[model samples]
Target: MIDTRLSDPKLNDEQGRVLALQRYQILDTPREAPFDRIAGLVKAVMQVPIAIISLIDSERQWFKSCIGMGDTTETTREVSFCTHTIQAREPLYIPDARLDPRFATNPLVTGAPFIRSYVGVPLCTPDGYNVGSLCAIDTIPREYTPSQIEVLKSFAALAAEELELRRVAQIDFVTGAATRRGFTVEVDKAIARYGRYARSSALLVLDLDHFKKVNDTWGHAAGDAVLRAVGAKLNALLRATDVLGRLGGEEFGILLAEATLRDASRSAERFRKAIEAIEIENDPPIKVTASFGISAIGPEHATADQWLAEADLALYAAKRGGRNRSCIAPSSAETQLSRPA
Candidate 1:
């Protein structure tokens, strides 16, 4: 029988856990040496054929590092032992897979890999969310000592620290939003997820209207204050799953996860109004407006650059159609304009 705690929404904070995991922006990214070395160390120290650093995504278990699983980067959550591992505070130890009813029919156990024994420690964030697991696997049934479990826990701590460090490094200083590199990484992951799941998502590229004049008239310090205010306002309006980033200068980007073009249009309109309402405290208060360009992720978008280019085009359209408006790609009929009345 499956553990109700793992499967039931009321018993666990799955949405929060997934959001915490996404905040690290590690999903679908290339393998890093730190995580790879950790997996290698786990394999060597535990004398196991397979060792993995797994991040439990909403629908799948994605491996940041995997040894002994040749070319396999991910698997569905249903067949993943790491899924169960993430649910508990203590290490999950299955000494014999064949004997455990949960594993008797699991594809990983009965088919390839043929895992007979497994031990996994939850990779818990500093705030207490279990995002994934660190595991050591052997082909034959075996019992792991308490000392060994402690070693695994130590490694898991290191992994969690790496994630926290990355999250800190990804933030833009002035705006308190993601930096260009960090935002681009998230766009890449969003593209990969769209390819795999066909889920609808959209990107909005925004540039503040006449931003250079703000710096020219009020000095750079005032400009920075305006940028910070706009960033905070946008952050307050966005959902937990949505990503906001300072792409450079007065330009920003927002990744609206699981939203359609229509949804993005409405959101962009809201953001435009919010930015217009922002007042920066200076010798004289400064109010600003932003022009928005939105592009829904589609099959035509093969890369982040492509997706961004489409939105950028729409942004240009918004600029031409007059500022403080939102435009959607591929058609003028979809453009949403909020001119001064």
Candidate 2:
């Protein structure tokens, strides 16, 4: 079970365990090149045999990437050096773990792992939650000068930047939703989690109607205005857990976590009506509206891509059926192809 008793001011359950782990989207992923580079740089800079980008999860510290270590993850947070680093929200420098009062008797130092000198910089979120650490360990006692510690902190910052860049690259710049590529990654993650834990989720595809007409009549500037307006309104209305993105043109998408068809439909309708009510103003008023296709992932599906393709088919059906209405994909519409709405 996940530990609930050790709540500290710097590491609340939501901020530290849930949000921190979720933001990276790195948990359970196969090793990657960028993280490998981070590990390599840490080893070279600190001259340590072990370096890791460890994320402290609910029950374990998972390595997104590691160097000079065969295991991808370690399951002992209660005794982890990273745990102390997170709690301190500072670099935990034990120049000699075997002599340090707090860690002299630590299993990591006294037992099989035999960690000695250790330096860890907390991996902090933008909101100031210190979730984990980027750390290096050696088998011998060592001291880092002030300059060396600062350099280690800089490396930790680089790791943080890698994480933030991953988010920015995946999220839609215009609407803050997942871009097409990002959506694919999301679906893959969702399906993997569902396959493991058996959870339900929903997807919605939206396209603005008569968007070209808005550009033609009011000029492209007005069209841009309408898109931005709609995007802002949606961002304001959706739950923080929900993901939204514009996928180019007047098309957009949403991933509604842990939502049923009824709940998803309610949310999609709210988005629909919100856009319908957006009245653009100049000397003349221009109004905009959108159509949506919504669907839920069901078990026994072949893959996430196939499921998304079905949703896209339903989107085509909604467009064909009517320009400004919402349509839900019937469970029977499981094929790659779509029908007219």
Candidate 3:
């Protein structure tokens, strides 16, 4: 049985909170020793049957590390105790769920794992959003002292710091987009999601047309300025779910989550036009244009490199077809689609 009247808990700044969570790029990633060790320590120190490092996403509460919950990695947000945990700054301590109206009919309480005691400390980001929780669960009623709660909060801070370190390393200094390594990691996650859930997505690789000429004529400083401006402009045009990254010099990559080939084509065209419209205030004013290559994630691609190679092929096609255009790689069933910007 479940509580039919239990409403989904949400933060007042939910959109901002989810965006802050996404900035870490941690969801669906493989477990690391730091997080696993923290969960293990919590379980040991708290003397709980289960301890988890959980991240609350839009639709699910995903466990970055789980101990004592057999093979279960996630649960629907509708049924998650962690959902309620993320709504506040302080730890949520339930001494006996069976006595609490909120959990009296909750599935996790009435069913397997038979959770009775719980404590969750919200994992707050640097920007002050509670993105998830570090929780300890027990199958029987138990009491937690203020000292115990403080210990959990200290663990939660370490988890938040771990997330911040990853975020800082992923960002590009000049463009403010993900660096090459970060972007590729995102692509790998997208691919894993596609394989597991059949979620469709597309990748767009953009290269500035005649970018060398900008450096030769204006100097490296001006070239850097152009990259920065272009990054900012493209970022403004993107949805919160889209990932923008600087792949390398004069090149960028975008991961369009849950988008189809047609959706990607339209997006690529828009980016092409946006890049073409960029103007830098140089001695005589400078304008720049970009070429785009798009490839939809599919079964044919086994690795991120293969997916990127396909997009690169389309990019070369765009270059051959004359720059300032968007081109789609030929699928197994169809020929390449190239559109002038």
* Per-model TM-score versus the true fold: 0.83, 0.84, 0.82
Q: Order the candidates by lDDT, highest first — what do you get? A: 1, 3, 2
Q: Give the winner by lDDT.
A: 1
After superposing candidate 3 on the true structure, give the runs of residues whose Cα lies further than 4 Å from its correct spot: 1-22, 44-49, 67-72, 75-79, 105-114, 192-198, 332-341
Span of ten consecutive residues with least summed lDDT in model 3: 332-341
lDDT of 3 at 302: 81
The top-ranked prediction according to TM-score is: 2
Model 1, residue 142: C-alpha shift (Å):
3.0
Taken over the whole model, the C-alpha lDDT of each candidate is: 0.90, 0.78, 0.89
Error of 2 at 121 (Å): 0.3
Steric clash pairs (candidate 1): none
lDDT string, candidate 3, 227-335, tens digits: 9999999899888889999999999999998887889989999888888788899778889999989999888878888899999899999999999998888871152
**Candidate 3, 298: how far from true, in Å?**
4.1
1-341: candidate 1 lDDT, tens digit per residue: 45757654532998899989988878888988999999999999999999999999999999999999998999999999999898877889999999999998999999999999999999988877899999999999999989999999999899889888989999998898999889988888889888999887899999999999999999999999999899899999999989999999999999999997779989999999989988887767898999999998877788888888889999999999999999888742333232222
Better of 1 and 3 by TM-score: 1
> Per-residue alpha-carbon lDDT of model 2 for 1-341, expressed as tens digits?
33423545546554445565576676777888988898899999889988988888777787887777677476577787887787665688889988888898987789856888989998877766776689988888988888988888998988888887887787766566667777667777767767888777788888899899888988988888888888888888877667676767888878788887777888988999998998888768888889888887677555767876777777888889977888888773442233344
